[model samples]
Target: MEVMQYAEDALTINLGNEVDEKINRQLVILKAAIEKLEIEGITDIVLSYTSLIVYFDVQKTNIEKLKESLSTLDLSDLTDSTYSYKVIKIPVCYGGKFGPDLDSFKADGLEPEDVIARHSEKEYLVYMLGFMPGFPFLGGLDESLYKARLDSPRTKIPAGSVGIGGQQTGMYPFDSPGGWNLLGRTPIPLYDSSRESAILYEAGDRIIYTSIDEDEYYRIQEAYEKGQYTVDIEYRGEENGA
Candidate 1:
């Protein structure tokens, strides 16, 4: 890991070269250090897919103090209590109205079952939350299922739609326009502005998708809309990316 001090109030830490679950786990380290300083002014702390960017107020905290604070941060020392990450199992229904790109994906040398099997076989890590509120940027897709995004992005992708664009896969949390090739739809409502924690998944959590039929999806959808259902969660250990 390499740490670079920028200007008088910013420090950038490089964990590695790529974005994945492994990199996302490093957020715990940053949160732990910041909590210790109890600094009066923290402008912003942004965690990208692979690096940690911390912005502080020069008026309240100096570069030397910031550097000293970062030096005490040991990635391995972060307590499990300091970070709250959970593994969530998202139930999705694939094919037919849910996945219009089914046949197209099959043509990419993948059978419909092969597609589902490949997608659900491993637990993915939530690398970051972006694109839309509560929508997680997940890592851990079976390379066999890799496919490019549609040449033309859909004018409107329904909320709860699951998609694969490039080497990654993600879920749509709101009814937004997007370009990812749609593969399925989940009944889970991932974001609710009224709730205290509007976003269901955050960076560093694990995610798994379980296949469900149309009938189950409808039942869950109705219950979810009423705020009576809770999404199921499943956990799996970390694996090194090849």
Candidate 2:
């Protein structure tokens, strides 16, 4: 691991140069460890794919002191099962209006139905949330379903729109311009300003997609809009996504 002063009062602890589960696991554990230390002056801890930025209050601590404190952290024991994880089920309606770009995969010689099936077959890992608020950058997409970005990005992709770009697949948490190939949309709200926690998923979580028909999609959408639907979440060893 490498520690560098990111700002006048912030430090970045880098675990690796690439995105991986082990790297994210280290980040989660390190964040917990730092919080457990109760290091005075620490104002905030922000996590990324493979690093975390620690913001501090200069009045209570200096760079050297914080570095000294971090240098002693015991991370060698951070193993596969050391940290907990959640698996979230995201129901999606592919093709037709929901997945306008579902036909894009045809260039790779795969049908939309097969693409949806393969896409939902595996559990994807949440590497980080970026590009927008509550937008999760997910990993573990089926190699066969890989596709390039649209010739032109859409002016506004509706929230919960699941799209694929290169080797990655993620959802647009808000209605925003995006270039990813949109294959489907989910009824669940990824970000709700009214909720105590606005963002649904975080890094280190896992996600699994399930296919739903148009009728089912509308049913979920209606219930969700009426605040009558509550997405269930499992404990450790469960969910992912945006």
Candidate 3:
């Protein structure tokens, strides 16, 4: 790991240069370790694909002291520790009105059912939440279903609209302009301003998709609007790997 001064009161820890599970695992462990320190000056810890930025209060801690403390952390201690991960199951309705871009894949000789099956079969990892609040940058999409983003981005994509851009797939948490190819939409709200914590998923969490018909989608959507639907989530203990 390499450490560098990022800002007047922040330090960037470079765990690796690639976006691999091993590097992410190390970043998560390190972030957890640092938080456990309850480091007096630490204001926030931001994690990325392969690095972490630790912000501190200059008045309470100095760069040298923070570096000294971090240097002593043993990464091996977390080898046996199991991180409890939430497996979020998102319900989606592919094709038709929900996914106008269904023909885009069909042009490539892919059946609509094949597209849905390919997209939902695997559990994807949440690399980070960015671009928009509660918008999860998920990894692990099937390469066969990969498609490029729209040359012209949409002026406004509805909330819960699931889309594929390049090799990645994600859902828009709110109404916003986006360039991703819309495949379908989910009924669950990824971000709710009324909640104490607005965002749903966080980095290191895993997400899985469940196929739903139009009827089921509307049912879930109505229930969610009425605050009666509970999102299906499972605790996949410890390690994120299968």
lDDT of the candidates, in the order given: 0.78, 0.85, 0.85
Ranking by TM-score: 3, 2, 1
Clashes of 3: 1
TM-score of each: 0.82, 0.91, 0.92
What TM value does model 2 have? 0.91
* Model 1 CA deviation exceeding 4 Å by range: 1-11, 56-65, 76-84, 234-242
Local accuracy of candidate 3 as per-residue lDDT tens digits, 1-242? 79999589899998788888777777777888898888789999888888899999999999999999898887766655777667889999988888888768878889888899999857999887788778888899998888999999999988999999998899999999999999899988889887555776788888998888899999999998898998877876766233
Worst 10 residues of 3 by lDDT: 233-242
Clashing residue pairs in candidate 2 (N, C-alpha, C atoms within 3 angstroms): 86-238, 86-239, 87-238, 87-239, 88-239, 206-239, 206-240, 207-240
What would the per-residue lDDT of candidate 1 be over residues 68-114, giving only the tens digit for each residue?
A: 76787666555333455678889989888998876677677888888
* Model 2: worst 10 consecutive residues (lDDT sum): 233-242
lDDT by residue (39-157, candidate 2, tens digit) is 99999988898899999999999999999988888677544335667788889999888899998778789988889889995788888888888888888998897788888999999
- Whose TM-score is higher: candidate 1's or candidate 3's? 3
